[model samples]
Structures are given as C-alpha cells and as structure tokens.
Target: MNKIHIIGLGLLGGSFGLAARRKFPELTITGFDISEKNLKDAEVLGIITEAKENPDSDTDIILLATPADSLGDILEKTLNEIGENTLVIDLGSTKSNLCARAGNHSKRKQYLAGHPIAGTEYSGPKAAFAELLDGKVMILCEMDKTDLHLKEKAYQLFEALNMKLRFMDPEEHDRHLAFVSHLSHVSSFMLGKTVLQKMEDDRNIFDMAGSGFASTVRLAKSSPSMWAPILTENKENILQALDGYISNLSSIRDLIAKSDGEKIHQELADINKIRDILDLGRG
Candidate 1:
C-alpha cells in the first residue's frame, strides 16, 4: 500500500483523506496537524489511517495543507526530507507566491500547485466530509512546470475525488479568484460587521435575520487564520476587486439618497443577469 502523508490535517486535508479512503482503499493516509486535537480527531474519525506529527521519509506522497504563509517553508522542508520519487502537492488558496517560492527548489519536479475551488464557511477537522470535493472544480496552476509523471499522480488524485480539472497561469488564477471568491468573502464579512455594529445586541441579529441575510453573511464565519494569508498573498488582485465592489456600493448609495426609483430598478435588473452566469456554472 502507498503511504500518503498529509501535512496540516484541517478541513481540506481531512476531506481529502475521507475522499481518498472511499476511492482508493489501498492507499494509507497519515495525517499531521499543528493542532494535536485536529490530528487526533482526524484519526479517530477514520479520515486517516493514523495521526502523525511529522512525515516519514518513506512516505510516497505529501499533501501540504498548511495556511499559505507557512506552505512555502513546509514544502521546502518536506522536499528535503522525502525521497526523489515522492510526489508533493499544495492545496493553497492563492498560488502565485507559493508556487514561485517552491518553483526554484531543486526538487520542483516533485511538487505541484493546486487550488480546490470548494469549501464552506466552516473549517477544521470536524467540518470535513467525504463529499466536499465531489463535482468541484480544482485549478492546477502552471501545469507545464510540473514533471509529467508527477502531474499524472495529481490527476489520479483529482480524478478519485470526481473533481473537474482546469489549468491556468498561477497569476491568472489568483486574479480571477480575487474577483469571484475572495471579494465575495470580504463583502460578506463587511456586511456582517456592519449589521453587528448597528444591532449592538447579538440577539437582535438572530431574531431579525432573514434567509438572504444569513446566506450573505455566512462567509463572515470563515476562519481568519486561513483567510488572512490568502488576502495578503493575493493583495494586488484583491485590491482591484475591492475597488470595483466599493464603487458599485457607492452608486447604490447615491441612488438611495436621491430616491431614484427608476434608476434603482434598472440597476437591480442589470444585476439580475448574474443568475444566468450562475446557472452556467452549476455544471
């Protein structure tokens, strides 16, 4: 059986373990996490064969699930410890910086940069489930840079999870995700913050919040530790996305201030086109 060592056994890594166990029974997933509780829970929950504090040199594959800020250092360290044939993949939110840092390593051929575009506001080992990756899109950035054989290993892992694969330039992936994914989280966080500030009493939010508010504010509950590095790593693209969102908000405020019902209706009608875009994405 092949031994796969998962470094940082949080939501993504734990979910991967569950998915891999269901798909590839022959592979043994050994999990390592900075949080001992997460590591132990992953093992006890049967997401992994065992919980480990570090990877063994004999492990055939290493999945880096640490926050993006620490991923580069962890990747370099793991590469140094593991064998030449071992495959390493990073499932980080932002790719450009992490990829660039690991790209220069002597064992770069053993590493692949990936972003699984699937997750919820919830986090940690408990939040992980086998179905999390099913039918999701996983972006493989700068695929040409990966060794052909190691790419095949990544493809096999992605295939096992039933994830659709898309390849792109690392920078392009970061830029596009900033607009669609990162910006939405920021908007949600701000919305939740503003509502909390206005209400003052937490009970008021729960008593009066509607389905729309709940859905819109859900991302605000996401882990700050995971998001902080992603925001900073993709700072340039996120700044651009933030500017566009702020501009739209300003325009809406102007319409509200003027009580321009007709223009407000037109603006909402234009935004309604997003439903079609969302429909096309459902596949």
Candidate 2:
C-alpha cells in the first residue's frame, strides 16, 4: 500500500504502523486517535509518518483498532467514506458484531474483518513495538464477502509482517475466542481481585507472591476500557466457559476436602498433558 491510515493509535494500531513502515519504508502512514496525546505520541515515536484529524480519502488502506464495542459504528462510518478501491481492515477482538454491522453496507467488499491474536497486557502508543506481530496468528472472518483484490492486498500486508493466516466464520471465531481468549482474561481479573481482597487482611501478601501468581494475574493489568466490551460482546460463550470452569473448580475443591488424593492426582496429571497439546514439551 502506498498510503495507509490508522484509527486508534493504541498498542495494536501503533504496532501495525511500526511493522508496516519497517517492511515498506516508502509507505506513508497517517494516524488518528480521539486522544490527542496518542496521536501526538505516535507521530513523535515514528510509529506513523503523520497525525491526522481523520483518515485521508485517497489512502490505499484504513485500519480500525478501536475498542471492541465501538468497532461496529466506526466500521460502518469508515466504509461509507472510503475510496472505491481502498481496503478497510479492523483489528478488533470480537468479530460477529462488527461483521454483522458491515453485512448490508454498500462497501462491504472493501471491508475485511480480522483479529491479530497477539499482544502484551499493555496499551497505548508507548507500549507498541515493531516485532509485536511477528510470528503471530492473523485470523480473518467472512473472507468470501470481501473483494478478491482487496483480500489479496490484505494478504500481502499481513504476509509482510510475518503473520500466519487462518480463515474462520465470524460466529465460530467469536465462540472459540470466548473460551480461549476472553475467558482467560476474566479468570485473571477475578484472580487478581481475590488476592487483593485477601491482602486487605494480610498487608504483605504480595511480598510472598511467587512468579506463578505474577504470571497468572498479568492479564488483570490489561485495559479495562478495551476488555469490558469484549467480555460482554461474547457473553454467551463466556458464560458457558465460566460454568464449566466453576464446575471443575468445585470438583477439585471437593476432592481436596475429602482428601481423595488418588483422584486429585489423576485429574491434575491429565490436565498437565496440555503441555503436549501446546507443544511445550519436556520443559
């Protein structure tokens, strides 16, 4: 793409600009954000070549990296104003809502629904780095609805960033992500809350916390403004995931309470096989 516009200069948007610029130095990247500081920071850090109040009409690509809940409205408005050949891509966490919003738009073919399965538990332009998306999964939903040329263009850009591609239905994407991604964030946030509540009684509780506790609760530090909507948008699947999680926790609790050491060991040992599934072999 000769010219690209990015809306929402947060971690994902900024990182995309950085990687795109590094891969294609000739590309002119312009960024816009509701927060003036974010736009300014992106320009100053060289993540984007310029800061704009809105996307330029003649740009070849437009990327939407706004909060998940706000994506539907923003994507609708973006498609209305984009050039006939310009491709628009959204990097929102949730897809079904955004895809549904674009379903009847005249420029539907120009729009691509995507989610980059990569990030740190950090936000803002300052937290972005070019290597953030390298070797990451870029999931595209409803590709059949997108124009062939536009889809090819998107594939080229994603390929340049060293992303592996996966195609999934929008509904299926949300359902699976609800379990693997959304549910994990909810668990981390609640785990952090549980510890903080206990720390009220034991002031130095964190002092005794180990690396495992720190790692497990890391996602609790993620942006609430970003995650709150994702958890709610995928509420159905998340609720189901929560039900299974709670049931398992209860089962484990009962095992410990009854001192059923054999079953508990078997349960944990079976769960430990996840390492093999994850390819974290012999670590």
Candidate 3:
C-alpha cells in the first residue's frame, strides 16, 4: 500500500486527495495543514486517512498545496525528510520561480512543478469536490528536472483523476498562463471592485446583473490570500498582458467618445470572431 501525503489540505489538495482515494482505495493518504480547523474539516469529509502537523510523515508522493510564495520554503523543508522514491509536486499557479528554486537542489529529481488548470472561486477543505479536476487540463512544467519514474507516477495519478495532461517549459507556461489564467483573475477582481463601488451609490444595480456578468465575475470570489502571491509571482508577464489589455480599452474608449460607429463596428466584428475560434456556442 503506497502512502500519499498532501501538505496543504485546501480545495485543490483536498480534491486530489478525494479523487485519489476513490480511484485507488488501497492507497493511504495523510494530509498535513497549518490550520487545525481545515485539518478537522478534511478528516470529517473523509478526504484523508489522517491529518498531521509534521511534513516528515512516511509517504510515496507529497503534494504541496501551499500558496505560491511559500512553495520554495516548504519544498526545501520537506525534502529533508522525503525518501528518495518519494515524489514531491506543487500545485501552485506560477511555475518558473518555483522550478528555478527547486532545480538546483540536491533532491531536484524528486520534485515536479505542476499547475492544474482547474479550480473554483473557493478555498479550504469544505470547498473540495471529487469532480473538481474532471475533464480539465493539468499542465506539467519543467519535467526534465523530475525523474522519469516520478514523472510517470504523476501522469498516472492525474490520468486516474480524469485530467488531460500537457507538457511545457516553465517559462513558457508562466507567460501563457499570465494571459489565460492570471489576467482573467485580475479582470474579475477589478470588475467586482468597480461594480461594488457603483452599487454603493445605486444598490439596485446589483439586481440587474445578468448571467454574462455573473460568469465573468465568478472568479472575483476567489480567495485573496491564495491569489495575491500568484499575481506577484508572475508579475512581469501579468504586467505585459495588462498593458496590452489597457491599450485595447483605450482604443475602444476613443471610438466611443467620437461616436465613430464604423470603426467601433469593425473592431467588434474582428473581436467577435474570437467566439468562433474559441468555439463559444451561440447565446
């Protein structure tokens, strides 16, 4: 019976624990977390066999579910007690920094940096669900640094959870994710902030929020403590994406200001084609 240890039993980690336990009932999962409440919740929910305070527990796989900023320190600390066959993987948003930090370590071969392109606007053990990672893409970055055997183990684990796996270099992953994932978070947060400010003056405005607005603003409810470090970790790529987005907004603003319907129409026509490319069905 192989033992799997999850270092942080939050939504992502807890979901993994649940899926793994369901898929491989013989495997024992030991969860560790700083929060006693979170650990208690995970135990009550049957996400793990037990919750412990020490990271030195015996396990074949260690999943670090801490925030992006705390990954390096946690990885280093856990490496001290990890067995040579024990594979350690982090489910952090940004990868380049964590990859670089773990690359030169003596136990680098045991570490795999991964970002599962799946999550909800929630956190903690209570928010976990078995189907969270189903039909989602799981990106494995900097695989070259991880041992081949351990990489195979990771692939099998994610596959069992019904996730599609993709490989890419850490730098490329960070740059692409800044646009597809990180920027969406920022946009959602700002949209919520703007709408909340407006609602202060017009309380009834919130009642008018449609499905589109709700869909776009859903990520605004994400945990700030989890997101703040991710935004900061991939700051450079995020800033570049923001600059381009702001420039596009300025162009639209100029057209609206002059009432230039022709240019505005053309601009929207070009942008609307994205729906076709993205395969968004007709509303």
Clashes of each: 0, 0, 0
Clashing pairs in 1: none
Q: Give per-residue CA lDDT, model 3, range 45-121, as digits (tens).
A: 99989777654445778999988888889998888778788899999999998888887789999998888988999
Candidate 1 residue lDDT tens string, 1-283: 3778898878898898889888989888888898888888988888889877676667767888888889988989887777876789999999988888888888888888899999999889899999999999999987777789767777888897899999899999999999999999999999998987887765554554666888889999999999999899899999999999999999999999999999999999999999999999775
Candidates in order, TM-scores: namely 0.95, 0.96, 0.95
Q: What lDDT would candidate 2 get against the real structure?
A: 0.91
Evaluate residue 135 in candidate 1 and report its C-alpha lDDT on the 0 to 100 scale.
95
Model 3, residue pairs in steric clash: none
Candidate 2 lDDT over 1-283, as tens digits, reads: 7999999999999999999999999999998999989988999999999888677878888999999888888888888877787999999998887888899898999999999999899999999999999989999999999999878889999999999899999989999998888989999999999989998888864354675998899999999989999988888888999999999999999999999999999999999988786874234
Residue 107, candidate 1: Cα error in Å is 0.8
**Per-candidate alpha-carbon RMSD to the true structure:** 1.6, 1.8, 2.2
TM-score of 2: 0.96
Best by TM-score: 2
Worst 10 residues of 1 by lDDT: 201-210
Which candidate, 1 or 3, would have the higher TM-score against the true structure?
A: 1
